[model samples]
Target: MSDGVATVHLVRSPARTVWTAIALSGAFLLAGCGSQADLAKVNHPRTVVPAKVVQKPQPNTPPRPVEPVFAPERLRAVDPCALMDTQTLSAFGVPASSRAVALSDCGNYMKDGAGKRLSITLRLGQNVLISDTAKTTKLAGLTTVESTSTTTCFVKSVVQEGSVVLGIVAQVDYEGDSCDVGRRLNESAINRIRTNAPLRPQGNKGSLTSVDPCAIFSPVTATEVLGGTPSMTPYDLYRCNWRRDSLSFGIEFAENTDPKNSSANKKAEVVTIEGVTAYQRKDDSFGNSCKIEWLHKATTDGKGEVATVSVDNTKKGVDIDLCAKATTVAKALVPKLPKP
Candidate 1:
């Protein structure tokens, strides 16, 4: 751990030189004691020798502190749908529907004069990705990257950069030149985020926007289901995942239609956990995984906000019942959620 060097200086023959000086002084004294004539014959001259200076070792320098990244709590508080308001949507075309897909993503769907579908999406606090072919620019004083495909164009402004990068993105899907719309929307979003990004509805006590998904279950519960201590990873405040060996578990909160009416879950088994109706889906398309979802509350747009518990057992030849394990986690999760 020592990152410094100590310097030492040594004079050659210093002990011998000191002894020779002492012997010469003693001989002069003895000769002086014998007679005054001898004292006069002995002549001694003073000589000065300079000592080498040794520098003290310096202490190790402390490591530099890491600079804090940009994390806007206000961005998390604002509703995703609020970014694409009536005026903003009308600028492009007549708006058909606007809805939140996730906690931080929203879509404003419109129709072109030829009846082709056009859409604008605003995404906040999202994971950043830039490809080699992507073009770079600046928006609202932040570094922005723009990527285009055959049908879609995306412009994202970097909000934080380091081990993990996060950004705010504006996406446009159109057959024509989509980057123009994307750039315009990105600028508008960045300005709104700076000055006046509309916030979520106030005083909704049952909302899960402020909850941390990783804190929902106890350690004992995690260990029991994962078969050991698991690594907990949070994709965001509303979603968390766990993994230990071949066993994996996850919990998520999102905006979705009701479980009973959702097309994706039409074949899902209807069940009840913690006295609330829930739908269970067993998917073997990739591995043995079971997902249980239940409605937490209804939003103002008639769509239900829901929570999910997913358990996957990928170990070969293991006789674990995935659905039962998913149910157990859901049972513990239901009581922790805020009641509507």
Candidate 2:
């Protein structure tokens, strides 16, 4: 038989080549365990996984309102004057010897226009009097005076008027005194000579009106209460009067230099009277000077209770004295006013 069919075909071809080499060694051990499980997931060890949460967007915002410290006519011209002299010594009437009574004005020889002519003399000693004119009061323009001396009675009055150019003489020295102490020192020197009167002409039709009762108490204006710079031509200072027990005020008259230019312009004339308002100021820093200021307020029966007085002109040289710095500028304007 041809070698028995070639030994069966070489034993089935060596069992089919050992079953194809065990199926190619189980497919190369399943492809090397699938590449070592992808190389253990590419060399493992990573784990961390917690990041994913975002939310942002916010911005916008707006809200703010609120609004008196003095001016009611300066609290109605406050001039309490120690409560008006303790209510005018408990209602009307004073001067029981008038023990130490004082009320003054003249603020050191007025000055504002430079007309310079001031002489205020009042002596009660050797009895020398002069001043009553219009031919000694025949009554034409009225310059009355009476008292031809009984024991020591002399009376004189000469007023040049406006800004005041006064000369008053009053004497009563009956050697034994007492006509109520010569009428309480002639009613305290005629109430300090009517607080330096002068400034009438209102209805007299002479045409001099004037106003400035401290600007009716304080709020000033009228050229800051007429301080300076008006050589005339209607500059008009101030004047006032209500009347009853008599009241008159005036200002505007300052000028008198050459004491070497008033001592090289250290000039002085500063008056600041509060209450009834009186402030006349002029300064040269204190060299050659002449100043005056007077301030007064009164009440006896006008309503009863109120009195204040102030006068100045530094040492009475240029001629206005009754100072205490006008009661220290009227107690510093009664605490800057504004309180009844």
Candidate 3:
């Protein structure tokens, strides 16, 4: 799905995993911890390379004449976590999670409980105009191209005046109906876009969309969770990591990233706190770490506010309670998010 340009699949723990390419190229985003994109052979070389989102959204702006009403470049400046909303992905089981976004692409590494993983990537592009003469059936007025593998299904649908392409992928980690899973996501995204709404509602000061992810966590909170003074890992605005050796932990905030893509296909459950919703994404991808993503606060742009509290015990030596601990930190976070 967006692994830099493709979503990389990790068969190892978050710390030792390598981000081997799966699909798309806006490169996607880094998986696990600190690793770059590495080339891996894939069956489909025809997959589209994702582009970047907008540089920023200037509120009350006029639509560009030459570009599509909703410019994919506009996504570059926006939050990748906001691309797909939770409502669109609920069919996948887990309703909330995190993601890495780019100007024209977004994606997540989704693992089912059985040790199978499906990496889904979304890409935005423009293509030639189409007529009813096309072979594919018209769904929500967009032209679509769909393909399927033994365990994966891909659908590339046209949105925004029938020229903007929305490329979506659903891969099963251990062999399920990835095609059906993907089709659901693909259809939901198209329906939402048709609403033609702005990304975020205007003048909501409680919104965490622009807050520095590092600032969201305090040292006191860090001590309460990871047992050490926390330091920034200097990755990106949406992600924050503690640099100390006591334990590797941090809060990763995503504007539009949907947890449904990152949540476990099975054994993933929905938990509500203070009337706010989030997903506890537990994956054996790395036996030593776990992620708890709060899929709370819906964005005006059709995505939602997601906060992922994660832990990596690869270096900590101590085997701690990942979910109980993550939920503990999440409790402190719900109060800080945007609310009605």
Q: Which is the winner by lDDT between candidate 2 and candidate 3?
A: 3
Write one digit per residue (lDDT tens) for candidate 3, span 48-165. 2222221111223422313343344333233334434343333344433545443234565655445456555544332222222323433334445454545555554543322122
Task: For each candidate, give its TM-score against the true structure.
Answer: 0.70, 0.19, 0.42
Q: Rate the local accuracy (lDDT) of all candidates.
A: 0.61, 0.22, 0.46
User: What is residue 210's positional error in candidate 3, in angstroms?
Assistant: 1.2
Residues 1-340, model 2: lDDT tens digits: 0112101110111111100000000000111112111111122122222211100011121000000000112111211111112112221122111110111111111111233322111221111122223123311121323343344433333222222222223333333321222223223333322332212213422111122224433323222222332111111122111111111112221112222223322443443444343333333232122223322222232221122222212222343222333343344434443332
lDDT measured at residue 19 in model 2 versus the true structure, 0 to 100:
7
Would you give me the overall lDDT of model 2? 0.22
Ranking by lDDT: 1, 3, 2
TM-score of 1: 0.70
Per-residue error at 330 for model 1, in Å? 1.1
Instruction: Note each model's CA RMSD in angstroms.
Output: 30.7, 54.9, 15.6
Off by over 4 Å in 2: 1-101, 105-146, 149-152, 157-160, 163-166, 175-216, 219-333, 336-340
Model 3: what TM-score? 0.42
